[model samples]
Target: MGNQPMIVMSEDSQRTSGDDAQSMNITAGKAVAEAARTTLGPKGMDKMLVGSSGNVVVTNDGVTILQEMEIEHPAANMIVEVAQTQEEEVSDGTTSAVVVGGDLLGQAEDLLDQDVHATSIEQGYRQASEEAKAILEEQAIDVGADDTELLEQIAATAMTGKGAENAKGRLAELVVDAVTSVADDAGVDTDNIKIETVVGGAIEDSELVDGVVVDKDRVSDAMPYFVEDANVAVIDDALEVAETEIDTEVNVTDPDQLEEFLDREQEQLRAMVDDIVDAGADVVFAEDGIDDMAQQFLADAGILAVRRTKSSDAAQIARATGAQVVGNVGDIEADDLGFAGTVSQQSVGGSQQLVVEDVEDASSVTLLLRGGTEHVVDEVERAIGDSLGVVRITLEDGKALPGGGAPETNLALELRDFADSVGGREQLAVEAFADALESIPRTLAENGGLDPIDSLVDLRSQHDAGQSSAGLDAYSGDVIDMETEGVVEPLRVKTQAIDSATEAAVMLLRIDDVIAAGDLKGGQIDGDDGGDDGGPPAGAGGPGGMGGMGGMGGGMGGMM
Candidate 1:
């Protein structure tokens, strides 16, 4: 008895179990979801995030806002991953996915409060998710890659809420053209579809380039401004004279010998240009530097040359021009050269860019994106990216669905009927899932400044009457047939959103315990040590500074 001693736990290791942990997790997850919810739909409001450095971001992009937040809680980080996965998979619908995830947790929390088992709620959600996928597949409309009008509608749908909304028509045309030009029977490779942004002109000036554009200038002013029907040579080797691999010293004491040495180097450089000229190459894209003498010779020979081109751009040019990248100048043959109608230098946005245009049988293409400012340019890029992703997914799956919350309303109305057949404590969860799904349209209505309940009630009534395509029109604050209105989204986007959100929510709901190690520098939880570097703003959380330590009040603010 005397040798037995009591053990004490250190405060550094903190643990929360049962209801406390679940409540904290639910609250955190919901906060993250609410952070992005307001940014959903066409009429969604933009968030003005001001960083500690006074840098401001005014955006409605879910991924961007989530990424900009500073979240530290582990549970909240998991919720952030849902948004990131949505972005990675579809490049759109991030906000909707997060909102649905939050709503699911909110519903589950209510079920937990009612003494319903977490396992039952999770099972119900999983079942509803599977059912949602089936509904999406059954209701989806078929689309082909060649359907230009529908593709434009898809593109315009993606850009409706953002900065590119004003120029969506012109931008959609450019996106479709660029995507189709680079697409073959196999599939669309977005890598071949490059978006080059220049912040100077209006979005209307944005156009598609048949070939690649590199932000590079010609090697010398003496070179021709433009080369037509040019024989393009892509040299990976340097134009400078090669030095001996083994280090050696040439001690030339005689003046004539030194002059001979200098002349030999000049001749070597000149010979390199001679070799390129002999290959019948009229344009040179050197992956490495071109010597001064070689540049002069190429200019005198009327060969347009760009030195030190990026390796990726070099390969892109090769693909577009049907040229081979030559490692040695001596081995460059006529067949190694590529053909391009014009290779010219143009000044864009106060910088020189080498424009390689009108290549025969080109496989690669570029979208020259121009906008009024940097912010507009960034937002425009995001819009085009979303369009490309949507188009690619639609082409691959050959399916699309009506947008403007029609799919959500349809899923909700159908889920309730399915819930009746479920018939268990799980049925409550299914019904809850149905209710959760309606939050999308409700939030959309609210963001559009309409009465959310009224809009949702009207939507539910329409869907009940067999109006499958009925959806909230944010612009007019009325429910309309999305299909007739030309509002559509990729089936993959909807299905993926449901799967990702449900999976994340289920994972969060199953957790009933949390153990965290307190700060090593101090004994407090999340407390700053005296050595705080002030790297990121103190208020910012990891992904979304949505958690303000305000407990319930802060969480509610995030939802609104």
Candidate 2:
């Protein structure tokens, strides 16, 4: 009895404790970071992720890359959440957030090896994160909504490493215009700015429409192709005869009775079309289907009709035209109709599209992105989306910072100085946090094909000399003024990235044990009761379960 081992848990359960668990989790975090490291900065390379279904997505966007990856480690997924949070809050800087998070864990790993307590590291990181945000606030430059030139630079900075780089200048102008056009006193709602991509033309052919653009075409070719000074009616209801809710049979023995039933159906549809005509609507955008009979009546009335428009598109059109979306067409009135300068059907990239443009004071607009191929268009769309996000943030927050890793380099220098104020072992953690931030500029230099050490040294020297805006110029590998180079990003992008990265790093640092329960039928663990089902061995950490930290390295390797 004295020599017997006590077993309280299931035989199929696996547990990893102490230093082994910490090391495995840290390694996982670093691996996830390393995967996105090369895809940072303006010279950053893009990643082509191939899924199990053989679907390929080629992009440098941090959130997109992490989301597309099939990560199994729970700790690694936490790092992915950092990127997702950044994307959700700022719409840009996902790569920076993820890279910083990974580097923070890497720095913490070095501290852990030095016998420093994880609690001290976590506390130090919290202090550094708060100080880093303060430094960002002090260094942020004021940007107003009317600063169109500066705003364009912000958009261009976001598009630099993306597929739209060659034509970023023109696209930046379009993005700024689109954003500013839709901005109201309540703040900018990005949803009001829609992006529509058309394949088969150079990216430079992209243009900003003053109003909404629907992918749908006119219901009938007989309908007017164009309407000037158009009035639009947006309806959510179908233009077909209403059917009874319950199933019932209509018994019609007489020919007259059958003829009356058909006549009534036509009249109901005609009335639906008449509602638009009576409301003086030159264009109709329907959320539901438009019956063939109703289409003929609409076409005869010289009204441009688009049927089965996506609800989102219909809502945007309504916002652009200042019209209210009515559920019942018969309830429409003249005031309920929206006004547009022109409603026309055009062939874009060999596809028929309805364009509503030149609406006065439009609250919704579209950017018609053109590209040479489907992949090109997709990449361009992604770039434009990022640009729009940053620009919108700048407009709403009214604060921005210089890019090219300027903010990070400055924060590192500032945090190191602040670490002195935060004494004790926690100060070491703060200093480590600072060092982790330098990775941003180092990776930027490396991606730009420059000497990382020399680039980092130059940036540190500049920041120490009170030149806070100094950062690596990826093109020349020189430490120059990012603001002078027109490299600017929304202040929220930097602040949010630091906050999210720090929180994720701290959360991962506090973990020291992992326990995974195995299933006998699934054969996740090696035991006498386990079935012969083919699954990764108990040590392999199959899928979402962390098996014994044995599969940690392999899980991280899969991400790479």
Candidate 3:
């Protein structure tokens, strides 16, 4: 009955299981949330992220911050995906979604500490998320494409905390005009609305063009700068003679043969120009290089030409001018030509740009954004992107809800009631989920320099009295109805945020094991000699290293 010796087997891979794994994942999730929670509402601050190459990006947008960071933790990456999904679906509310997801995990950790099963927490969160979605649908207000005023409000709501907040009113109007101008029976076609930004002018000087804007000016000074009632042709191919597919020698032994070859090439180029002129076109957009001879022919025929136009710009021009882009010049005809009321080359913001304006029944348009600096222009572009996205969402979904965390507070209130009806340990998880929903308004108040506890208390009182639309007034630090105050967002944003945040939190809760392969190629963790640096183990720095609730709560409290 005596064993020679006791032997144990071990694997090379580093594995973290049970409570240790859950703690690590939750800590990582909360760290990600803590990073973005500071940038939550209208009063949120911006982050200046400097890259390894010294490139700098200053933004409060959640997706930009997460994308720029080099996050290594797998659980943290999942949180980043939540923000990405929010941005993709609603184009705004990314920060809120991520923060809420982090809070959900934080709350689940508390329940786990109380010995609650992970499955019960997951089930409770799923039920709570469904209830939240239903609540958002019930709280939504109707919107339509024809309602420009409402659309402007939506844009302003998105741009409130962005760098362009000062000029949000003007930019919102321009965004609304551009989206409505390009809207079709299918809905708003945002691609058809091009945005061109140039640094120098004030933000107030930005304007919307009823037609397209090409960055390229006239190809030659001899070309006409302005053509009225222009007949435009979009050529997707080169205006020069087609090149031979394979290498060849012309074998021109005499000057006469050389002259004939040169003249033949010129004739070919001239014939291409002649085809356009015969088609009754006064302006041409060539997607590839236009030979010098062709330009001379076009100019001599009183036609304006732009060469090497970007494919996107060319498609936009065709849309604005009602032209069909022809792959071959020989296929072009008068009927294939497009029309524009005026095609002119002008000096705009110290740059030469081709302006195609005053087109009748034009379905495509452009917005020229002006600013005093490169950073300003970049921020303006981001702000306008969000604005346009919300406008499109409102047009397509035809519904919206009050912003400033009103819907979230209402969900918290209703979820608490729902939690009371459930009689089990799962009820504790449901109650935790309700408390997690309050992080939004609490964050908004915290970011706005108000006492989160005081603000949340007042908000709860207001929502409990049947005033569900009541939300925090970040500016004044008062409880007020966001809907009545003109602070609103697309309904899809709220529903998607709740759905994505809950899904991420639930998925993370079910992860109880983490296995990491040793880096043999790096020769650090899996050394041949088994050399140890007396350092912590591979997974030691994970949740085991995380300071408990007090430490994390202190970190989060500092954000307020």
Whole-model lDDT per candidate: 0.83, 0.84, 0.84
Candidate 3 lDDT, 1-560, residue by residue in tens = 39776534245556678998898788768777877898889899987766656677788999987777655467777999999998887788899999999999999999999999999999889888887788789879999877788889999999988888999999999999999888888888888899999999899899998889999998888989999999999999999888899998789899999999999999999989889999999999999999988889989999999999999999898888889999999889998888999999988899999999877646878899999999889888888888899999999999999988898898998988998887778788888888998999999999999999999999989988988889899999999988888888999988898899999999999999876664212111111122355642333245323211111211122221
- Location of the lowest summed lDDT over 10 successive residues in candidate 1: 520-529
Candidate 1 residues 1-560, lDDT tens each?
69997656565666667877787778778877877787888887787655546566678888887676555567776778888998899888888999999999999999999999999999999999999899889999999977889988988899989889999999888888877887888988888787789989899998888888998899899999888888899999999988799999999999999999999999988888889999999999999998888889999999999889889888889988999999998889999999988999888777899888888856778888998898889888988999888878877888989998899999998999999899689999999999998988999898899998899989989998999999999989889999988898999898988998899999989987766555312111122222244432322332212223222212212222
Superposing all C-alpha atoms, what RMSD in Å does each candidate have to the true structure? 5.2, 4.6, 5.6
- Model 1 bad stretches (over 4 Å): 1-12, 50-56, 235-261, 264-268, 271-275, 278-280, 324-337, 347-351, 517-560
The model with the greater lDDT, 1 or 2, is: 2
Task: Estimate the TM-score of every prediction.
Answer: 0.86, 0.90, 0.88
In the predicted model 3, the residue pairs found to clash are: none
177: Cα error in model 1, Å: 1.7
Q: In model 1, which residue pairs have backbone atoms overlapping below 3 Å?
A: 69-543, 69-544, 70-540, 70-541, 70-542, 71-541, 71-542, 71-543
